[model samples]
Target chain A: MKRLMAIFERDVTLAFRTGGGALNSVAFFALTVVIFALAIGPDRARLSESAAPILWTAATLAAMLSFDRILQADFEDGSLDALIESGDLLSLVALAKASAHWVSTLLPLILATPVLGLLLGLPAHAYFPLMASMVIGTPALSLFGALASALALSLRRASMLITILTAPLLTPAIIFGVAAANAGARGDALFGPALMLLAAMTLFGVLVTPAATAAAIRFNTD
Target chain B: MDERPADAGRLIAARDIAAQRGGRLVLSGVTLAIGPGDLFILRGPNGAGKTTLLRTLAGLSQRAAGALKRSDNASVFLGHADGVKAALTARESLSFWRMIYSAPPAIIERAISRLNIFPFLDQRGASLSAGQRRRLALCRIVISRRPVWLLDEPTSGMDAVSIRAVVDLIAEHCRDDGAAVVATHEPLDFGPGRTIMLDEAA
Candidate 1:
């Protein structure tokens, strides 16, 4: 518990204290969604139809933007070397880092999703479902983002690689997330099943992300 | 955990340990032993593989050639990067490390005063000078209370006073039955420590 809190507290403090990356995530998320809406020429019907998937995609990319923040700083600054010296500590740090990333980056976007929802012509019916699906799915984003951070720690440029690799992996979460929100807005009966799968994906991430990320970090330590 | 007793009655041995970095063999044919109350200095030229040896000893990297053995307790690695985040205050950073190391709170106070970091404990890492950052990084040793310290160029970018303080801290840590392997080009005033000099890299 102390170890987890140590990582969590410091990350949160830095996230708010610097006031850059966290805000940038929300801004990037909002901008991407808005631009998509505008680029489609402000047709409310088409905009509403695409809004849920676009928001989900924007959030995923924004989460990736800050993926390097999870372990890159530790790797570059040699903190990860110290933390990973202990066999057990690396896994704990991985879990703590993923939790911190969600709290710092995704929480803000979830809070701001309603406004972005309105701007993108999301129907009133979709607001809660959008928020609910994001709440369920965004943690997976942070978890996989940590995994990507570890995979890319030893490389010079990794974002593009991360996108190519994780896009196929994240497809299911994105599909279920968008399906839930779109169905909720359009009063389709698949909403409950979609949301259930979204939540299950987040739970699955909670179980596996730590070990995967820790192994990646350990590999990079060499 | 392993339930092994702490650093007491423990020894770390390296026999013909070879290390590589960036796909090139840097150091080879090394042997040493570190026990409680030991102060071991790694003296070599810039490319003599001092850092690589330290990393191998710390278990941060695998040895390419021979075997390395140490106590069940892990050694702490302090590298050139200070590990101080620019957004955090000195005190906050120390507290964070304290929590990570599972150290007592008293160590934080002692380290802060011993290093004379109280003047800027509340200041952000970005606002500190290079020497100050180095000093803060050295404090992690005091905070960790770990049995073994693998320090790579620990005193770089520090003034005379700061260097002296670090030397004293290491000496004090040794007196407390702790061991240290410090990798550096410059010699420090740590008393009675054996020096392992490395020749050209292989």
Candidate 2:
């Protein structure tokens, strides 16, 4: 737990203090919402119906943009190797890193969703579910994204490769996130697919990605 | 020479450890036990598996054919890269690592001061020279107080003064029952040291 906290805190500190990683995500989220609003014209009713999917899509893209830098910086600087040698539980370390990523990339986007919703003509009911779904779903994005980050650490074009490799895997998050938000907007039970698929993705990410990342770092460092 | 018995005071144990990269055999059937307080220096030419062997022993790389065990989990591995972030100051980098290793604040303060990096603490790592960045990376082990240190090309980019500082730090640690496995091509000339030539295994 201590080591995990250490990794988590380190990532959080880096995200906020050094890289300005969080701000970039927030800016992307805000800019994307603005451009989207401008492009769609003044048809408020159309925008309200489509608001949930649009907001979710923008948030997902913002999160994706920030994921590559999560592990790449650490790998480049030798912290990853040092952490591996620390004899701490690798999964805990991975979880902490993912948590930090979520806080930086996803948290800001989720926080900005209400304003975004208003811009897109979403009602209070629609906006609330969109925000709730984002809160539950973005951590899974962070988890799976970390694997892609680790895999692309040593590549010449890691940023671009991260998108190509992980975007396909992120299809499930998009599908379920859109469904849950839509259901919640329609006054239906949102717990079924929204909660289940997010939980499943979180489980798979926690169990599988860390070992692969640890192994990938081990292979690449040599 | 105070020869800590390799069998009795083993810091690292590898059995039948082999590694491959890009389908090429890097090392095969390699086995060794390094004792406590031993400055085990690795020597080999480029592409000779020196870095691979060090990383595998440090558990940073996959071993194709064997097992590796460490004593008490008291180890830190420093690779060829400086590992400092360009955006973060020297102090921030040290503090970040100190947190990761769970070292107390006092130890971290003492380490930065001891390494003469206190003056440069607020300077970004990107602004520092090659030697200064190396010093920043070394500070973690000093503050960590771990029982073992694993270094790959520790003094690769440093001048003579920085090299001496690294040697002094290693000697102090070994004197306190800590061990170090340093993989370097340069002559380190530290006392009570042993050499592991990869060509011998070849």
Candidate 3:
């Protein structure tokens, strides 16, 4: 438990440091949303209609910006080897890293969703659902992103590989997240089911990604 | 989860061990044993599988073929990379490892002083010199309190004084009944120990 906390604390501290990449993720998310709004013009109805998908997609892409570095730093510097030698389960270390990534990178995007939603002209009714979806959905992003990061560890052009590998896995979270927010915006009854599915995806990611990530890291290190 | 007692005689033993890197055999037909107070030196030319053998003994790489046995004593591996985080200070790195190993604070203090790390304790890993970074990484071995140490080129970037400090540290570790397998090009005096010639192993 102490070891896990140490990993988490160290990762979080690194994420906030210069060249840590967490701030870049948030900046990318905001810029992507703003660019979409500018490209879509001042058609409030059009912006409102597409708000949920735009935000969800931007969030997913932003999360990807930081994924490549999540385990790459540790792997390159021999920290991963030392970590494995620490006698703790690699799965636990993976969990700590992913959780830290979520907190440092994804959580900021979720927090900024409200402001981005305003820029998108999203309906007030959709606000809660959008934030709720982000809250529940981004963990899946971080979890699977960690897995992809580990899979691509030490490879040249690893960021591109992480994107290609993670996009397919993240489709479900984006789908369910956008669906939940759109349902709320349309005043339909689908929000509950959509949010539930998003939560389920995150829960499943929590249950499975750590071990999968550990296996990937083990393979790469070997 | 080997249930053997900590005081078991042998630390590590291997016979007919074969190790591979990049799917190619780098080392083969090796046999050795390590016990308490043993300091085994691995010497070889580059690409002669010195690093591969250290990594294999550390269990970081899979052995292509071998009969290996360990006595449940935890071993620490220090490789070519220093494993220092650029964002963290030297002190922070040691404290973090100390926490990970659940090592007592006294050991960390001892390591910091013995390795002459106090001068750069607050310097971030990115700013530390190669030798300083190596010293910080070596602290993990002391903080780990593990009986067996697998070190690769531990004195690569150190000056004469730092090298002596490290050699004395290893000698002290061996005197305390701990074992070490050091792979290095530079000669270090660890008193009495066997030397494994990887060129011959290959």
The candidate that achieves the highest TM-score relative to the unseen native structure: 3
* lDDT tens per residue, model 1, B110-148: 999878898899998999998899889888877877788
lDDT assessment of candidate 1: 0.83
Give the candidates in order of DockQ, highest first: 3, 1, 2
TM-score of chain A of 1: 0.94
Off by over 4 Å in 3: B1-8
Task: Name the candidate, 1 or 2, with the larger TM-score value.
Answer: 1
What lDDT tens digits, residue by residue, belong to model 3 across residues B139-168?
999999999999999987898999999999
Best by lDDT: 3
Reference-based lDDT, each prediction: 0.83, 0.78, 0.89
Q: Using alpha carbons, what is the TM-score of model 3?
A: 0.97
Candidate 3 lDDT over residue span A18-132, tens digit each: 9898888889999999999999999999998889899999999988878987899888889999998788889989999999999999998888888988888887888988888
True contacts kept of each: 0.77, 0.72, 0.79
DockQ score for candidate 2: 0.56
- Interface alpha-carbon RMSD, every candidate: 1.7, 2.3, 0.9
TM-score of the second chain for every model: 0.92, 0.89, 0.93
Can you write out model 2's per-residue Cα lDDT over A77-128, one digit (the tens) per residue? 6777787667677656777788889987788789888888878878887777
Worst lDDT run of 10 residues, candidate 3 chain A, spans: A152-161
Cα error of candidate 1 at position A18, Å: 1.9
